[model samples]
Target: MPTKKLGVYPELLTSIEKARQLIIPEDRIRVLNPLIEYIQSKIDQGQEINLNFICTHNSRRSQFSQIWAQTAADYFGIPANCYSGGVEITAFNERAVASIKRSGFKVSAKGDANPVYYVFHSDDKEAITAFSKLFNDPINKGSQFAAVITCSHADENCPFIPGTEKRIPVRYEDPKEFDNTSEESAKYDERSLQIASEMFYVFSNVKMPA
Candidate 1:
């Protein structure tokens, strides 16, 4: 089946092209298989696909996962809604935000301590609203959503997420370790593109209805 391509910002599209070229390791593919199955099952049932990427803090990894997953779904015409949350609320890190900008997303924020960010991947698409909040926050889907654990801390600590249909661990290393170092920007971008690549990989395997 042919994929339905959507319009994306030219520079972001360039990043996507690069993301598509990265090789996901076999072990990582094994880990991602469950997410693919979850999406496929939702599609097979003609149900809405909701994915909530969760981390200890809604600062970095989860945010990246949510944004990239939504983008990949859009690119593949899969109709998935993506969101991110944490066990505890902490503002989305500025470093992560900068990495996203470097990837060609246009971003705007409104707030001080914990600003809500409006991120745009395409001129025509609705902006992805990003901020620090708990996974069960009112803005997030309360039920029938897959809870994707994006960091080891959240995965282990969040043994149970109230409304998730499936809880899948897809951990990523924290770029926080590199904060304040010269490698901060590069490391954050690396993690962002890694998640982006894996997301595109997951959606690429999904088969849409005829």
Candidate 2:
């Protein structure tokens, strides 16, 4: 509900806006507008919007999506809460942490085996609680939520996510192939940056209140 503003530079906003127009389809753009308008109206009326990103694993894609979306929303002066979860429980992967750090986020170690993490960004520290069990955590509880599926498997298996106003399928390819590769670090960083850029596109074109 709090309209937190990051106040990015005007030139950056212009570039993000341009990038948004290129990434999203016109039809998909139309589909997103209704929800976007509603969200902005709620913000205008002092309500916070929430988005939940889901994948098969909590490590790479969804984690990046959630953090970047929150960052983008804040950068755009949108009142939003972004959370992430997975169908199977796994701690945030080490590759993700390293990549996130490279992208300018501060991370606090949450443990050893399946240790969680506190991904710190700007004025927001999203309580990025991850669960191995589906829908078994506090991150899934909210009145205003958008269910964003980042993987094909979870999206197919769990077609309907309870408590979400919109179940959006925005799938991303798994970056696990880079595992054990020579370019592991660079690959993870690439994946993280891709997610971040896509999320920036999402908020840039999202309808603001009229």
Candidate 3:
């Protein structure tokens, strides 16, 4: 399938290109298959694809998944709406935000605590509005969506997510472990790129309807 030419900032394009080249291990591919199947099912049904990435804090992993998933879908010309949420409100981590900026996204924030961030990847597309809130927050799609658990905590603790059509676990290590350490920036960037690469893999596998 042909991809849409995105007018994203050059740096982001570079990042995306880099992500596209990274190899996804077979183990990881196995873990990501459910998400791929869910997207394909949506395409087969000619329905909108809604994915809500859930983490314990809605601060890091889930945020990364949300941004990268949406970006990848756009790149592949797949119609998908991605969102992120948590069991509790904690705010999108500044470290995670910085990592995306380093990877080539334009971001702006509003409010003080738990600010809403507008992340723009392409000039023509609307900014992805990001913030930390409950999985059932008003801003997220309430039903007919995939609940992507991005952390073991949320995946294991939150047994049931109301209104979800499927629950898929695509857990990632928390870069929070390196917070305040010298590896903070590097670790966050690593996780962000990993998520970006994986998301690109998922969308790249999706076949558009004939």
Candidate 4:
């Protein structure tokens, strides 16, 4: 599929492209290559690619990873599913949601406890459904999914994810550190962009079928 087929929002396209330029340190790509290889192997076998990003709170970084990874898959014309969860359920932080909105996504929320959000990167593309839930939530695949631990705490605490084929610890710094401080928005957007950059890199590196 041609890149044009993605039809992502113009603003988001700009952001993703910019994020791509920001990915640095050749070692980071080396670190992420395993994940790229795993997804590629699944695609080569014509298997469904399911990624479950987990964090302790399921609030910020994990949510961004899910959204960006799914978007990157779509942008690359790869058939994959992305989901996010935590060890314990907590609402997707409003601050993180705000940062994504600033990044050009359209977000609509419903309910309170673990409210579901329909996040759209473009008016033409289907929205990504996001919320807080357990890693094994019924909405997520029960087996054969890669468990991507996005925080050190979750990775250390949940040593064994029951049925995951691969467990990748691709940790990120918590933007929560800056919460209620003057740097809140900037740091949140910074973290979101960093994840977005890495996700784009992963999908961009995949050897999609011709």
> Which structure among the candidates has the greatest lDDT?
3
Give the range of the ten consecutive residues with the poorest summed lDDT in model 4.
1-10
Candidate 4 lDDT score at position 47? 97
Model 4: per-residue Cα lDDT over 12-75, one tens digit each: 7778877888946787777788899899999999999999999998999999999999888888
Positional deviation of residue 51's Cα in model 4 after best superposition, in angstroms: 0.6
Q: What are the models' TM-scores? A: 0.98, 0.77, 0.98, 0.96
Checking candidate 1 for backbone clashes, the offending pairs are: none
The candidate with the higher TM-score, 2 or 3, is 3
Model 4 steric clash pairs: none
lDDT of 3 by residue, 1-210 (tens): 337777878999899889888999999999999999999999999999999999999999999999999999998899999999999999999999999999999999999988999999989899999999999999999999999999999999999999999999999999999999999999999999999999999999999966
In candidate 2, which residue ranges exceed 4 Å CA deviation?
1-47, 123-133
All models, RMSD in angstroms: 1.1, 4.6, 0.9, 1.4
Compute the lDDT for candidate 4.
0.89
Choose 1 or 3, whichever is better by lDDT.
3
